[model samples]
Target: MIRFETAGESHGEALIALISGLPAGIPVDFEFVNRELWRRQQGYGRGGRMKIETDKVHILSGVRHGKTIGSPIAIQIPNRDWKNWEEKLPVEAGDPAKHQAVASPRPGHADLPGALKYNFKDARYVLERASARESTSRVAAGAFAKLLLRALGIEVASHVIRVGHVELERAATWDEIVAVTEKQDVLLSCVDAETEARMKEEVEEVARTGDTVGGVFEVVVHNLPPGVGTYANWDERLDGLLAWAVMSLQAVKGVEIGRGVTAAESFGSQVHDAIHYGPETAEKPTRFTRHQNNAGGIEGGISNGEDIVVRGYLKPISTLRRPLESVRFDTREATAASYERSDLCVVPAAGVAAEAMVAFIIAQQVLEKFGGDSLDELKRNYDGYIQQIRNF
Candidate 1:
């Protein structure tokens, strides 16, 4: 099975991503991978960390002459900020005086629970791993997954739908969503300029009040074939897997598939899409069509030949500037929560991370369904499946 794992702390020497089970002959695009990393650092309300780091992937193995060789892939992204923290966070035992302890835990952060579980006196270690900076490695790895999906004529993109009380007035079209990625500067990543401006105002207000804001983002997977997932087993359900993947992101409190949240309040007729049949075309390999996509391109745990839409409801960044009420980790005395250098908002960045996760999950499903040791073999298998669906 195709899988990936990430290592290294937020302020460590570097972040590492190890991906395995990729077919041979898949081209490696360094620029595209680095661009994914760069996209993760954009958006309003980002903190000083983005300024200190310029993320670029360094391939260590499993690729030669710009192509995969049917082996494990190892990727590394050096942390420029590590230079300043090298002495404070050395691997070997160093001077105790150099240790910077998080005397008090930040509210809503992993500091308290992580320390309690690991028997740590300081929450610094927890802070290092729990930070959203870890998502950089995920984005890098997801970029590779995107490359695989792209070769199969599938594309993934995301956009901000809401920021605080300001939300997109209408559903974003596929072209509009894809256009957001081509812009030179990304402001909140909303498709509508007027709505994004409102989001900016909300962020500005929060920054002035020393508070943070959160919002929702939608990830759209286009040109995905039907039957990528199976309903034979509960764990193999596509919707459940997609929900779990998106919910795994830091600060994301909820996951919604299509109109799932609102569907609970609506009638069945209003929630379900009507089906129709049309002649098979190059763009749509299958003859089946839907009047609407309220099902989010998924029904009964499998893709249903429409764009898959997933929304992530992200909470505000946990580390605050003004801080909140809390107690010292060692002493029980009540005090203000510890303050840290953090963002005022990160919904746009979170959307980018979610896109990567969705891409990885879909790629995983694709590989499981169309097994091959080489790119050509995989395409042949995939093409056969497409023909089978078209003839159905």
Candidate 2:
């Protein structure tokens, strides 16, 4: 089975990503992987951390001559700010005076619970691992997943749909979503300039108030053929897997598949997509078409030959500059929450992370259905499946 894991703390020397079970002969694109890391750092309301770090992946194993060799892959992204933290966060026991302690737990962060669980007097260690900075490694791994999906003619992208009260007025077309990634600068990752401007205003207001804001982003997976996921088992459901993956990201409080949230409040006729048959094409191998995609390209836990839509509802960053009411971790007495250098908004960044997770999940499903040890073998298997569907 295809799987990945990430290691390293937020302010550690570096973050590492390990991926296994990918077919051999998949080309490794250094520029594309670094670009994914770069994209994660963009967006309005980012904090000083983004300024301190320039994330770039250094491959350590499982790749040679720019191609995978059918073994586990290890990727490392050095933290540029590690120089400043080397003394404070040394691996070996160092001078206690050099250590910075998080005396109080932040109200909405993992600080208190993590400390309580691990018997830590300081929440600093908890903060290091739970920080969104870990997503950098995920984006790197997701970049590799994207490479695999790309070889199959599938693409994944995400865009901001709402920031505070300002929401995109219309549904973004696939082309518009793809265009957002090609821009020199990404402002909220929204498809509409006017809406993104409104989002910027929201961020500016939050900054002045010493507060933060959160919003929603939608991930679209295009050119995915039907029958990628199975309904034979409840756990193998595609929507369930997508929801679990997206919700695993930090700050993502909710996950929505297609119009799932709205369908709950609407009539069945208004929510369900109508089907029609048409000429078979490279894009639509089955020659089946849908009148609308309100079902979100999934029905009965399987892909139905339409673009898959998944939305993530991100909560505000837990660490606040103004801080919140809390008790000291050591004393258990009343105190203001620990203040940290944090962003005023990170919905756009969260969206990028969600895209990575969504890509990884879809890639896993693709591999599960079309297992192969090499790229050529996988494509041949996938092509044969497409022909089978076309015949059906």
Candidate 3:
């Protein structure tokens, strides 16, 4: 099975990731992997931490000369800010006076519950691991998955669609999304400039109020082959897997596939895609086609040869500039929640994380459908499957 895990604290020395079950002889692209990390650190409302950390991955194992050897891949991303934090958070015990203690837990954060779970008097221990910085390793792993998927003609990308009630009125085209996301200079990461401007205004307004804002983003997967996921098992459903992946991101409160939520209100005829048969060409035979993609490139838990569209809804960052009411863990006295340096909004960055997650899931599914010990072997299996699909 394709599996991966990430380890490290928010302000720890470095983040580590281990990914396994990939075929050998697949090329690893270092620049693209680092670029994915860079994309996650971007966005208009990011905090000072983004200014401190420039995430870049170092692959330590599972590849020889930039290609996988079909073994587990291990990577590390150093925390540049660890220098300033070394005295406070050393691996070896340091001075008690140097320790940074968080007694008051933020209301919406994982501080209180996590502290209670671990019996930690200081919420710092909880908040450190709970921080969204953990996603850095995820983005790194996803970048690797992206390289794998790219080899098979699949591409994943994401862009913001709404921010704090400032929603894009219409869906953006594939070209528009690629044009905006690929650019080095991006603000809200929205394809519609005017909508992004309004989103900026919304962020500015929220900033003035010492509050945070949430928003929605869409991840699009292109050139995916049909019949990858199965209807035989509920746990193997593509929609379920996609939703779970996107929802796992920090601050992401909701997830949807295609017109998932809207379909609930519409008639069955309006919600479903209409199918048609296409004429065979010189390079291909007769094929099934759909005029609309309201199903979001999936039907009955399987991909139907359309672009897979998934949307994630992120809640506002829990750490407020103006603290909320909370009781101190030690004192048990009510007070303003402790203020932590946090983003005014993170929808754009969250979108990038969501893209990574989607890519990883699709890559996992692709591997599961076309398993092999080497790239050439996997490609042969994949090509044969495509031929079978086209002929069917």
Candidate 4:
């Protein structure tokens, strides 16, 4: 029963993440984890918050001497921006006049509805928790999951497939995804140089217009063993879980597995991947192969020894530089929506977040199938399952 939960506000003192159910003896990689956090803050069109915050995880509990001890792991990422807001949002009650309040709500944000539900006078409280800043904690958790999957010969990577009107027509190879995503300098993490250039132009146009742009990103998981997810229950299905995880990201409006949405418009024969037999080798007495991956490495709610392809569609940043029309909470008079410091585009960042989410889901499924209280015990069970399948 692997699980995790996150707490803290967008501008709170620190973001907190608690993850449980990991077996003992899984070594923690601080460098890799920090690098993942760095990746989340990259990409063009990011706001000033990225410049202010250099996210670094501080382990609070659950491990000692750099290895898990079979307990819940806790991590904290301090908010550098909290310093400026401390007086305005102190834990202890302060002067009402000193606290910042938002009388106007952003049109596309959670401000209005959240304020109404909480019976608040304004949107300040709602915006604090609803901000995408919370994903920072999720990225930290996902980094651990990536480490777990790496030990099992599985890898996860992601890239932007579209930005505004610019889109990649061809599917990216595993090598291409790794190459582009790993690059320190990229135009929104797009694999194609020409396409990425166009995406940059599209971003520039939106920035000039004081508007925002949305696009799609694809996450790929490679070398994952088959039969990781179950078909017995709808909640246990890998596709459903993956979809839900990706959709949980802020501003992500849609999710797709393999060629999911496309398959609906095409005939069954054109959509499904055909099975083929391959020559046996010493390590494997029998082999199965698929020339196409339209099914995205999953079929009947289980991994099928192919690359798991998931795509997330992100809407434009809800907080616009040029505000939209809205009514003021107090005045009830029509006016421009309250403006918040926001990005002109965030699809590339969303892709990175999606990668973390997908990795977390796969990690949970792996633990569920290969249950163990220690890394060594889990490995032995996993190896036995692989051997059983190889000889089938």
Which stretches of candidate 2 lie above 4 Å from their native place? Answer: none
Per residue, candidate 1 scores C-alpha lDDT tens digits across 174-213 of 9999999877798899999999999999999999999999
How badly does each model clash, as a count of residue pairs?
0, 0, 0, 0
Task: Give lDDT per model, in order.
Answer: 0.93, 0.92, 0.90, 0.90
Clash pairs of candidate 2? none
Lowest lDDT 10-residue stretch of candidate 1: 278-287
Tens digit per residue, CA lDDT, model 4, 64-143: 99988989999999999999999888899977787888779997789999999999988988999999999999999998
The superposed Cα distance between candidate 2 and the true structure at residue 204, in angstroms, equals 0.6
Global fold similarity of model 1 (TM-score): 0.99
Instruction: Give lDDT: candidate 3, residue 148.
Output: 85
Candidate 3 TM-score versus the reference: 0.97
Backbone clash pairs for candidate 3 read none
Off by over 4 Å in 3: 280-286
* Global lDDT of model 2: 0.92
In model 3, where is the ten-residue run with the lowest total lDDT? Answer: 280-289
